[model samples]
Target: MTLEQNPALAPVSDLPGPQAWRDIGVVCPFDMALDHELWRWMPDGVNLIFTRTPYYDQPVGLDMAEEISDHGEIQDAVRSVMAISPAVVAYACTSGSFVHGVQGARNLSKAMVSAGAPAAVTTSEGLLMALDALGVTRVAVATPYLAELTDRLTSFLEQGGKSVVSHEGLGLDRDIWKVPYATTCELIRQADRPDAEVIFVSCTNLPTYDLIARMEQELGKPVITANQVTAWGALRLMGREAVGPHQALLQATKG
Candidate 1:
């Protein structure tokens, strides 16, 4: 009758031991699609839980009032999915995540916990963690957000003890669909700073798969994009890593 009465509904333990398959929840915009780039080099068996805000119209500015308005809808979707009891959940908007500054980051995590997934919240904000993990302080950035949101990101990173040495923003707001793959690649080429140790391609909506390898090579540095860091932090919270070359960090822990 209920899942509790059916073995198939329960978690199946693997041979020789128990390996948990945890879910990582993402709350983002509905019109946007999941780019496999998140797990590009990730291992296997990890899962994703995505919830998106129903669409609405507004200016592209990054004002606090506008930011709060957008997040209201996005967070509503997040709360609904969080009711599902995910292991960890994060609000996936880079611009929205940091709109309130560092406090916003803490608040988003707190919100996820309140919604019932008490593990952690990973954001484009979490990329800061990845940068810190990689020992990057001055970095390059790329984004699909408008100038307003990009400005907030600059402030957010500066507050984090890092500096955005150089950056680029495409100035798109409601429709992230128009950010062409070639344009995103060009943004990387143009925004990348020669002296920077890390390049942060800073949005989740723009597909990043095509440029990751090239960006690493050109900059001669480790590049951590938003989705990459988002995936890394979420998978780590889930206690599993998908197996693939994209998992540059988690591969060492697979033993």
Candidate 2:
């Protein structure tokens, strides 16, 4: 029994070789609660490595968004994930990236690249790219933020040369992730307008993966969510496509 005679302990032949995982680093806000939603957009053989910015006790608001988006904090977070040498790093917070403005979003991506990420994408920038990919100019936006923050998103979109035909917000400063899909659907309904070519559901913490295709069918327009665009943009930078089956953004042919 001591001479390697245990049948249960014998190695099996034809074992698969080591997996070749394509890693994408994700830098999220401390309060981000939808890592699973991000994963839903990833294709097979891809892995998402997430690291969060330092926690801030402040409620989710302009100040909180600004604090969590600090360049130094984000750079540090990017460095924390650099050991894995991710193909691209994505800053996966919508409000944090857009709260400052278009240039602010670009700065965040630049900082991540400076911090050793070969490439970087911020959610706000991703939204712009999604709009471009879909060839849409007028958009309706739904958010779980206050009027002030929601207004900032409108301005960001305007700066990107997209018209914000209609927009709505829930005015909540925290617990955005806890929002139910029914409520979010109603918000989208309220935000949607006849002139809007597309509808954007902002806020990475807000859950919208299960609602994108449904909402698109109901609204008769493409629906792009924060997490969806973030993952799409990151994967596109790596010359890969995201895994949203019926989502228009994922299926769009970029020119």
The prediction achieving the highest TM-score against the true structure is 2
Candidate 1 lDDT by residue in tens digits, 48-132: 6777766546654575324442544655766787766677776665666777787778777776566566676647557777777
Clashing pairs in 1: 41-245, 41-246, 41-247, 42-242, 43-242, 43-243, 44-242, 44-243
The Cα RMSD of model 1 versus the native structure comes to 6.2
Off by over 4 Å in 1: 1-20, 35-42, 63-75, 242-255
lDDT of each: 0.67, 0.92
Q: 4-54, model 2: which lDDT tens digit per residue?
A: 576555456543446799999999998889999999988898999999999
Question: How close to the true structure is residue 191 of candidate 2, measured as C-alpha lDDT?
Answer: 96
